[model samples]
Target: MGRLKVRLILAFLSLILLPIGVTGSLLQLQSSELEEKERSYRDSMNELESTIKRELTQTSVSDLELNALVNQYAAEINIKDAEGETVFTSYKDPEAAPHNEAIVDSSTLFHVQAEDGRILFVELSSQLPFTDTILRSILISVGSGLIALILLIIGWTWYISRTILSPLKEIYAATEEVKEGNLDYPIQYRRKDEIGKFIRGFNTMRTHLKQSQEKEEQFKEDRKQLIANISHDLRTPLSSIKGYVEGLQDGVAQTDEMQEKYFRVIRQKTDQLDHLIEDLFQFSKLDLRQLPLDQQFVDSRVFFQSLLDDAVEDGKSKNVCIDVPRQIPSVTLSLDPVRITQVMNNLTENAVRYGADSIVISTRIDHDESNFTISVKDNGEGMEKEELTKIFSRFYRAEKSRSRESGGTGLGLAIVKSIIEQHGGSLWADSELNYGSTITFTLPFLKKELV
Candidate 1:
């Protein structure tokens, strides 16, 4: 902008100055020529006057001869005396009356002659040479101005493109790269203007982003190390306890009472170990994509009902219900029934112990046919809104005090979520304090829409 402003000012001034310069130069030259012509004319006029006076002194000369002498002097002086009429006369050819008298422009000389030799007509035209030169000067001024304007435009455009536009383009490209997550870019454009300040701000932002990424990476490494250490320590003692409990139950240690006691301890230790390992494994899987999924044609109603029955028939003494729809659509999918069954079992058991004794397993087939949803509802004791949010997180138990005593592996719900996600489904929980809780999961349709 600064350079453009300068060019604009120069252009306007040139519109006036250029013509004046050329015209003045030509005028100076013409004025010098006129002065020399005037000087020569004056010298010739004085010498002619002296010769005419000398001719007049010869009284014996005839009238024709006197006229002839005067004419000879007039031809030398390049001047003539007339009645001031619009006619030209030359002294060299007076009898012939050739038209042409004095020299034109500044080269012309005139001297008055009278009967008393005091006053006579004396006139000369000085307009022709000066006027011609002025016209030529005006033409040259216009041509020269046009040439200079063309050259100025070309030079200014080149300068603006190289020093301004190109740098702005580079700044734009660097800003795009920063937007795309490359936080290290040279954003310094030394413009000494607002653009320079903008570049400095961008560089500062990049530095902040770089520092943030470095800290996040370091935190991730520390977390990984801590999880590995805790997992190792847990697995080791669990294996020992399991082995000893099996030995006693098999009669290697003799008494039934001892066996029952050992088995109880074994159960608690195994639950703890399993919870830790599952939490780590599920978290690791969740961080990656393209996890393996094994699915098959399945009637979810029957599939979920069996899990309820199995859990009820098992050692746990809880009333579990299969409250599915009368008719549930069957879907063919790339799924693993075994893994899915494990997920259902985990949710049912969680409901039975943590939320309620009586559980209802049901299915919802919506009108859109976009997906099939399965829910397990419990009425024992519901949880808070905050608890439901963290319920699917590993090792997160709403009733911390009660949960630690139940011998539950806190990773059950988390494991269920991971399995469902791998099958292209999602899971969520809805609960109200003391009103009961319901956990629902949706599996997308095999053909992109489920019945």
Candidate 2:
């Protein structure tokens, strides 16, 4: 389809070219009509002159008879004798001659002999059919037509400006508003054309920019909250370590027994601080998308076996019993082993800390074999529906008091979610209060496509 510019050009060009062409044609028609009229007048004048000659030569008529004969045939007639005396005249008012010699004078003067050898002068006065009055009328008609064409062009140009240029002006105004940070302003034009599509695109861009600004603002607010939470969480362990160190230095733990206990407490607090700082580092890397993934296809059976074995060893002292299918399917998958290991370790440790005796890790292939679903379940004091929804949010804990006491940094599940997303997968949790909680994530399996 042609664009609006091309269409408008064609419209204006036709208006200009067609009118000029028609006017030229009309001018030619008028000239041809005038030429035909002049030719007919010349023919009539020639016939009159021939008749005057034949009658005076062939007929035995006197000058008066010849004058009467010529007057009877012609519209305007005059005759003179050999001595240049007027013998006959046709005009009632002789001074009021009808001839306009400048335009197309047909008046002629010729001599003829009478039957008795008398010389006579024959004068015929006539005019062509196309006179100054008729020429002026044709010129006036052409002028009127030209005026009408010019008015039409002007009116069409006005209409085109209203239809096309006006909308463009509005679009430019909208852009100016946008430039001044007025994204809320709207373009009101609504047509099913290129201009309309442009307006819609502008509206969409405005909406996206507004949303982006809102997200950036929200991110700033979230950052503030994160800093506050991290500071408070860090101060707890630091304060405990400081207090125990002071006790040691001030001889509050004078005996070997007290000193040992104080040292142990200080070490535990130090470990908590270390874990919290590490989590903060990891969260920052993931948030910035700076963490690299070393993805590769590996046998699922071997990968899950090693992962579960390590989890079991770590949770052995905590009475954390974990289970996995012994005959796990040897399906091949593309994944980042290090990241997935981090995910499972975090989930397993969370379960062990939350007083879960048993943890189950299982996997299944989708019916279409397009994806593999991995689920980790624990029979712990599960969360409510509302808590489950926010379980993956940074620093969101199901039980804040218990989390603080248990030295939970509240970033494990959040990190888990980030890793899963980085691997192009989705993660969610399902749970019922007092029953159990299960976290499931899906990883797609690719197959070669037909080219």
Candidate 1 positional error at 52, Å = 33
Q: What is the number of residue pairs that collide in model 1?
A: 8
Of the candidates shown, which would achieve the greatest TM-score relative to the real structure?
2
Mark the regions of model 1 whose C-alpha exceeds 4 Å error after superposition: 1-259, 271-291, 299-316, 319-322, 367-369, 407-410, 447-451
Best by lDDT: 2
Model 2, 61-174: lDDT tens per residue? 443354443444344677788898976676534334345534454678999886657788988887543567566757865785688688878887887787678988988988
Candidate 1, pairs of clashing residues: 88-100, 294-335, 294-336, 295-334, 295-335, 295-336, 355-381, 356-380
Give TM-scores for every candidate, taking all chains together and pairing residue i with residue i. 0.49, 0.64
Candidate 1 at residue 430, lDDT?
A: 93
lDDT of each: 0.62, 0.78
What value of lDDT does candidate 2 attain over all alpha carbons?
A: 0.78
